[model samples]
Structures are given as C-alpha cells and as structure tokens.
Target: MVVEKNVSLQRCNTFGIAARAQALVRVRSVADVQDVLADPRLARTPKFVLGGGSNIVLTGDVQALVLKVEIPGVRLVDETDKAWIVEAGAGESWHGLVAWTLQQGWPGLENLALIPGTVGAAPVQNIGAYGVELQDRFHSLDGIDLLTGEAFTLDAAQCAFGYRDSVFKHRAPEAQHGAPRGFGLAGRALITHVRLLLPKAWRPELGYLDLERKRAEASVEHPSAQQIFEWVCQVRRAKLPDPAVVGNAGSFFKNPTVSPEQCQDIIARDPKVVHYPLPDGTIKLAAGWLIDACGWKGKSVGKAGVYDRQALVLVNRGTPQASVSGGEVMTLARAIQTSVYERFGIRLEPEPVVV
Candidate 1:
C-alpha cells in the first residue's frame, strides 16, 4: 500500500468542499489495512477512515492519516427459505448495491435508493430514506479495530440502531451511556464487510406522501420493488438538487422528535404544522417545513445557501474555484438551527459529520 502525501479532497465529498489530506492510503483489500497497521511509523499516526465522502463537512485540511476504503465485492452469502443474505465489501456504493440487489431479484432495499454514500458509511449513520432504515435490512458487519488491529463482528441489535445513529457514530465514553465499552466503533474501527438479510416475503413500504402521490399518478395501488425504486429516484430528483450538478449532502438536518405536549403547543399556535406520531408516542416534526416557515429557502449565507426546492438541503452556491468553505456552510447551518429553535422551541440536529 503506497501512502500519498497532500491529497486533494474536493472530488472526494458530495459537497465538493476543498480540503487536503496530509497523508492518504487506499485500502483495496484487507491486507492493505493490515499493512497499514503493521507499519511501525504509519501505525503510530491517528487515522481517519474515509468512505464515499458523501456525508461529511471538512472544516480544514485533515491532519490524521486518511485510510480510504476501496474493498469491492458483492455476492449471496446464503439463502434460506425465509430470506437472502447478501454480503458486500465496504467500498461498494450504497445506491449501486441497492440497484444490484433489485436486479438480482431481491425485492427489499428499494425505498433507500439514491442515498449517496458507501456501504461502510451506511451503518455509521444508520442511513434512512423514505420509510426504510439500514437497520431494518441489516444482518451483521465485520470491522477491524484501528488500534488493536483486531477484527470483530456485530449484529443489528448489537449496533444499537437509533434514528440516524449507531454505535459507529459515538465515541466509547459518550456511547457508553447504555451500550458496552467495545460497543462504540466511531473513530475506532474500519468496516470491511456488511451482510444484509432481505426477506423472501418483502412488502412494499409506501407510507410516504411522495410515494402515494406517485401511485396515484401512475394509477397503481401495489407497485413492484423496481417500480418503487424508480418512483423514489424520480421523487428525489425533483425534490433534491443533484449532488453532481449542485453540491449537497441530501437532508441537512434530522427531523426532530418532540413530546406530545410540545407538539400540542405547536399545533395550537399553528395548526398547519406538519407532524407525525411516532410508535413511541413522540411526534416527529417536518424540519423542512419549519425552515421554510422561518423563511430560509433559497437564502444564501456567504457561498452557502438553502435549496429553493427543499429547505432541508443546504447547497454550495459558488463555482468549484470559489466553492463554499466549511465555515460558511456551518455558519448557515447554525443560523438555520438558531432560527428554527427560536421560533419553534426545538433544536435541530445536523445530519452531516463536521470534520
């Protein structure tokens, strides 16, 4: 494994944020990772595991030795009468894997189409789109400890999947609030493989309003998995700016959940406030609606701006040569957060990792 110095990261992330890595290594195989760990000088440096770079905001040049995962493969690990266990290398594109599964006649994972990231990063954020989350289809994953060079595996429950959260998102101490010590994998492990269990009797998840509207437009009540996948892509293309054409990291904030009393108070003040009752009796508020109501859509803060179509998305308004800086992006994000919090008495949590 050759280590390169001063690597440009503008094309690495969906945001197209200009940044550089002091040193970077590409791990296309497990042996490459082993080589990195085995090296005396390299092994001593703090490392950063970079995936597709779709879900991060780089504040400045990365000082840690960057390990770019590029392991690649997809195969059926096993198939029971009940489900199909599909395994993929961590470096595979998340959307590509979803499409590949559908082409292979696996019906599940259609709802999570067009999520721009690598398979390795999916579980880190517990990525969810439409009505589906990664934990729903997750079986198990294998990762190598950065420090000890020890390999490990974890099941769905062991990951402690919460709303857009997992053990991979927290440090050991902060993550120890409920889970065990070795449980938190954030900044500690590099995922190598992920196995997904797709059920045989998969049912379509069309609870989202956009999907239902597509159903009406197409005049079909029950759609196939492929059809649902197409619908999701179509809906996303219309609602969200293409990261390729316009830099963005999909949804910029998590949909905040509130108590029933808080929901009632908001509802009383503005009855049109969009919300849904969660299974746990908490109410999930539409963050996009709150941002739009607060008059932030299409507004620019320096070179960072809110998308005109969807307020949940923040975009880089400058050209590649004059792209938005990480500080500008965070400034706009903080302003939006402050406004939403002040108006609704609810704090909005950022979705992207700020590095």
Candidate 2:
C-alpha cells in the first residue's frame, strides 16, 4: 500500500501533456484496491483510475489519488459450439490482447486490432475500429466499486454501450445516453477484467471503404481474418500518427450523427460531404471531413496542432521538454469544434475525456 506523491505524468498520457499526480497508487490486483479502500486516509479521498492513458486529456495536474491499474492475465475461459469466451486483465494492452487472441486462433477481435489503451479502458469508451465495436463481442466484465470496494460483474446490456459511450463514462442518469440509463458508474467503479465472446464461425468485417479498397488492391474476394487484421493496421497506421513518435489520442472527435433533413441540408451545401447512413436512418458525418472542410488540417494553435493526414486528430507539436499543455490541446479542440459547427451546423463531440 505504498502511496507515491508528486509523480510525473508527462509520459503516462498519449497526448504527452505535461502534468503530475499529487498522489498515486499502483493497483496490481483486486486486493490492492481493497487495501486502498480500507486505508483510513485514502478511503474517502477522490480517486482517478488510470489505465494506459490512451483516451484522456489532462487539463492540469491530477488532484485526486491516481490508481494506476497494472493487473495482468489472459486465458480462454470457456468454449461452446457457437463461441470462444476469452478473459483478459484490464491492465493488458488492448492491441496486445487482440494480437494474442489471433495467435490463439480467435478471430472476432481482429477487426479491433491496433487500437491503443488498456483492456479495462476499452469498455469505458466502448472502443471501436473498422466496423466492430467492443459491445459486439463483449461477454461480461468484472469490476470493483471504488466507493464500497464491492466486486461485481456486468453483461453487455448492463454496460449501456452507445456510440463510443458506456455507463462508465457517465456521472449521472441524465448524462447517460444508453438504456437503463438511470445508473451511471463514472468514477464509482474500476474494471479488473474483461471477457470477450469471439464467435467460432468468424467472419471478416469489410464494410468500411478503406477495408473494401484494401480487398480490391489485394485482389482477394474473401479475405481471411488475419489478412483483414493486417489491412486494418495498415489503414490506421497510414492515417493515425503513432503516439510514441508524435503525441496524440487517436481520433480527437466523434463523427456527428445527423437527421435525414440535416444530412440533406449539408449535402445541398457541400455535395462532397462524407457521410454514412445508419440502420436507424440517421446519417453519420465524418468529423475529419468537416474539420478538413473548415481548413484545420495541418494547422496549429500554440503547441497543439491538427495532424496533416487526419484532421480529426489533435496532436502535441512540442517536444518532450516543452510539451503541449492540456489547456493548449483543449483550446485547439474548441477552436476546431467552433469552426466545424459554424460551417456545417453540426456540433462535433470530442472523443477523449478531458481530465
């Protein structure tokens, strides 16, 4: 139960924002969290559960006790004729889990490969790439209630997944957009393990245009899961800057969904506007296209800049010593949001949680 104080957090986050945690604890197991809860001084203190720090923006030094989740393990927990259920510790790298599953002959997770962050954070954001969302393959997850240190498990429906959102991302019923929205976990819970239901009769998801293009280029009519995995990696690598070389939190904004009327209005304004129709009749507009339309690509505001290749990505342009501050990143993000809204009449929601 060693509580470290004033720890540097510059490298902990993908944005490379200069920040620090006033007090931090590394939780390697469920008992570690129970220890934290049992401690007199720390029990009631405000706490922040940090995973890979891939989907967050630090506006300033974290004032709460930072519980860095580092639990680890992966195994095939169950198998049936329909699927293979696999479990992984929340602290495991998401991409590492995907690759490992593939190596073990699991195929459903291949479409979600190369996404940054830890497995625990995946359900928090309901991470998705290509055409597959975490909810699509989610079996169940085990977590601890930070307030009471009570352990529990939840199935997919209980997670309340919706468009890169989940119950864990909300603070109250009003803030939650998914079903059974009356309950919002937010900071109240800490995930320890996630189980995924990978189908035995696997099928490659090639619905996205980039994936379709890859298939055409490769001249493979029916691509294998491994091939699709490689293609997705290539597509993402070409558009997204590696967080190691250049600091970024992947897509900075969520693609805004609009009504049919709004989509028509935008189409009339700019016929070249990129959009995809949903099953529910709403249209999802590309946030990158909107930002690029507003001429934000390759532009910068102080130390925060939009990546040239992908307009949706907001990056830290400064070096390690003089890195971008969280405030700078938010400023640039707000500016981009304002511009895109002014031009397209659609408000873009940022994907990362601004801490």
Q: How would you encode candidate 2's per-residue C-alpha lDDT over 20-96 as one tens digit per residue?
A: 99999998999999999999999999999999999999999999999999999999999999999999999999999
Model 2 lDDT, residue 88, Cα: 95
Error of 2 at 9 (Å): 0.7
For model 2, what is the alpha-carbon lDDT of residue 101?
A: 91
Residue pairs of candidate 1 with colliding backbone atoms: none
Instruction: Give the 10-residue window scoring lowest on summed lDDT in candidate 1.
Output: 174-183
Candidate lDDT values, in order: 0.94, 0.93
The TM-scores, one per candidate, come to: 0.97, 0.97
Task: Tell me model 2's lDDT, rounded to 2 decimals.
Answer: 0.93
- Candidate 1 per-residue lDDT, tens place, 1-355, comes to 8999999999998998999999999989889999999999998899999999989999899999999998999999999999999999999999999999999999899999999999999999999988899999999999898878998999999889999999888887644465446456788899999999999999999999999999999999789999999999999899999899999888999999999999999999889999988999999999999999999999999999999999999999988998899999999999999999999999999999999
